[model samples]
Target: MSNIFTEAEIAYLESQPLGRLATVGPGGRPHVAPVGVFYDPQADAVVVAGHAGSGFGGSRKFRDAQAHPEVAYVVDDLASLDPWQPRGIEIRGTAETFSDGGEELGARITGVMPFDAAWLRIRACRVLAWGIDGDSFELSARDVA
Candidate 1:
């Protein structure tokens, strides 16, 4: 599907790193963690990378993607708690695990985080975003909106 965000908004979110990643466990449980991401404009997808050794539920998510591809991620800029300074991005998608092209994927992911050479890939299906300021929260873009 085409992205809901304008290229400008997408570029803003992509400029920030450290997003919260959400995945499902084997038992259909939800999992969340902070992660670095690489956004590919060409594919209109976000790729997340993690080391095989990190063992922080990434493996399970990768495995789960094989059976169920649904997933979500959030990127928030909380550097300033000032309500008006809040800028965040939320992404929901069908994920696919790809390992055959580790080197290439790693290279792309590494551009986001230098230590991300050992992770697998999760391609985002949808993305939502909002910019919050002291006065109000405006929807920049979202699949649901």
Candidate 2:
């Protein structure tokens, strides 16, 4: 669902620079990789910029997402190891790839990947967040649709 991210969730996502993206690979296997992730409030979608290398278009995550569409993304951190506190959000959604003309969005990552044509746009279907909205031990979950 677009424009469904809560204020807390949006803040959490925007504050983080990296996230793990999980997608389906060959033979229905799951694959996950570290991505340059961002929260696009205007589009209401989480964007993964292929800023790791030059071959982002042929990347496994991109191909897998293209074939499967369904994906999960996570951005989290230990707020305090001493206090045993963890904070994070997990997003479940369908991904769509923009083959070209993503220079504006891709520009979010400067000097990396050189404004390439490959990127994944994930529109959330479900949201699960913790340690940022309610009791740290309680999960805040909802279906975006």
Runs of candidate 2 with Cα error greater than 4 angstroms are 108-114
State which candidate has the highest TM-score. Answer: 2
Model 1: lDDT of residue 103: 47
The lDDT values for all models are 0.60, 0.81
RMSD to the hidden true structure, all candidates: 4.0, 2.6
Q: Which window of 10 residues has the lowest lDDT sum in candidate 2? A: 107-116
Error of 1 at 90 (Å): 0.7
Model 2 TM-score, 2 decimals = 0.89
The digit string of per-residue lDDT tens for model 2 on 1-145 reads 3367778877777778789999999999999999866776667888876653566778899899899999999999877898888999999999999777556676553433444577778988999999988757789999985
lDDT of 1 by residue, 12-55 (tens): 66678678778787788887867775666556667766653454
